[model samples]
Target: MEEVIENKFIAIKSHINGAPIEFDFEVKTETISLSAKSKEVIVKNLYVSIDPYQLHRMKSCSSSQTTIYLAAPVQPGQSIDTYGVGRVVASGRPDFAKDDLVVGLLAWGEYTVVEEGRLLNKLDPMGLPLPYHVGPLGFSGLTAYAGFFEICKPKKGENVFVSAASGSVGSLVGQYAKLFGCHVVGCAGSQKKVDLLKEKLGFDDAFNYKDETDLNSALKRYFPNGIDIYFDNVGGEMLEAAVANMNKFGRVALCGVISEYTGGGKRPALEMLDVVYKRITIQGFLAADHTKNYGDFISTITDHLRTGKMQALCDISHGLESIPSAFVGLFRGDNIGKKIVQIAHE
Candidate 1:
């Protein structure tokens, strides 16, 4: 007889429209059998990623849904699936077996049943922490690598600017720019994050965007000459400022717009005249769209981490109970790095 497991997972009480509060989420319990069907696997989740983007998935109607199948919205009471690291407990799949460590889209709860066509694969920890697999070595790393090198296409000695520089993807992008010989500058919401970018992440310069009343002037101050590449994670005013300060033929990799994600910030009225006159190229990219570079990214980033050329700043909260608060912290600028919840200790 198969043993039944009581799984505690996060579910929304209602679809959120504005910034999510802790009250928006609730813990729900379910009973599952320790069994798997053919081509399916049951995984005990360890670390689930806590991301601001998850807010979009909780919305009743969001543009994110149309952009990618992964961003499809979930209704109230449905399990919130996120990228995470887990240990396989039961498997009917030939490639995966018991005790295999895997990383991919898993539920926010204690266990996830992965079926065919879902993103799940065995993970090689490479002597790094399991949390690293959830952050720097996982979704965040891929997003930074692809958006900077693939979309921005940086050049040596070029001026590179990153918004939300202290966060997961932005921090890695700044490090990669520095390693590639590009002059890098980053902006964060707080002074602590600015210092982390400059002192720890090896960025040439970093500043608190909130301190500057005029964002355009701030950009001009940082990139005195002009910016060659702009990794935009925060849109609205910052995007407009970056566009105004970009040099001719500059590239903008539109990653995520943290500013407007929850519909709080006003839409940016960018100067289209500057965009046209400067001949700038602005492109939006998702990490999922750049899977071709995954092999190279893992190899290169692993080497960088091993050699001390890169540093991963991760902020982790413990237990499934912390999921809601950890997510809400992103908007409050309470986290200095990647915000992740350690669901279970490995």
Candidate 2:
């Protein structure tokens, strides 16, 4: 007789229009047999990532307006899905077997049944921390790498700036720019994050955006000669200021606009005259579009990690029930680096 296992997962109470709250998610349980169908696998989730972009998946949208990059919106009663690292407990697929550690798109649940098409990639851990796969070595890391190199096209000794500088992707962007021989400056919401950027991440300079009364002046103070490359994570006023202070032929890698993700607000108006006069190039890129560079990114970043050239930081929450708060914290800037939930221990 097949034994039944009770699985707990998170589901949206309803589609949200503004910022998500703790009440938006609900924990539910279902019983499943410890068996997988052909071409499917049952996984026990270990670590799940809580990223700002996941908010897009929680909104309700019409068919024509439902175009979201990389993910689709979650239905009211359906379980929410995100990238995670898991251990396979049961597999009906020939390639995957029991106890196989994998990293891929799994739901915010204790156990998940995944079909072949949903798997993103398998993991080897490789003497690194398991959570590192979901942090520096995972999607966020890839995002920082591709957005900086492919989009920004940075040059040695260039003046670089990153917004939301202590978060997962932005933190790495700052460090990468420094290692590339650029003068890196970053902005974060709090003094602690500023310290992390300057002292820990090796950013040339960093400041608390919350303390700045005039963002344009603040940027000018840091980039006296004008910014040559801007890795934009929190758009809006920061982007406007960056544009106003960018050097001619500058590059803007539009990685994310976390500011607009929650709380309905008018889009920040930019002075196009500056954009035209400066000849700045702004490009929005999705990391999924640059999977071809994953191998190169892994090889290069791994070497940096092995040596002391780069650092990866993770802010982890324990247990499945902590998923809601952990996820909501990203928008509030409550986390220092990568915000993740640890569902179980290896």
Best by TM-score: 1
**Residue-by-residue lDDT tens digits, candidate 2, 1-346:** 8878999999889997788999998999899778788888899999999988877777786342356435677788787778899999999988888999999988899998898788545688888898889999989999999999999998999999999999999999998999999999999998988988888999999999989999999999999999999999988889999999999999999988889887664476888987888888999888888999999999988889889899989999999999989988888899988988999998
Poorest stretch of ten by lDDT in candidate 2: 61-70
Each prediction's whole-model lDDT (CA): 0.92, 0.89
lDDT of 1: 0.92
Q: Write the per-residue lDDT of candidate 1 for residues 1-346, one digit (tens) a residue.
A: 8788999999999999998899999999999888888989999999989888889989989878888878989899999989999999999999999999999999999999999999999998999989899999888999999999999998899999999999999999999999999999999988778888888888999998889999999888889999999999988999999999999999999998889988889688989998999999999989999999999999999999989999988899999999999989899888877888888878
Evaluated against the true structure, the overall lDDT of model 2 is 0.89
What TM-score does prediction 1 earn? Answer: 0.98
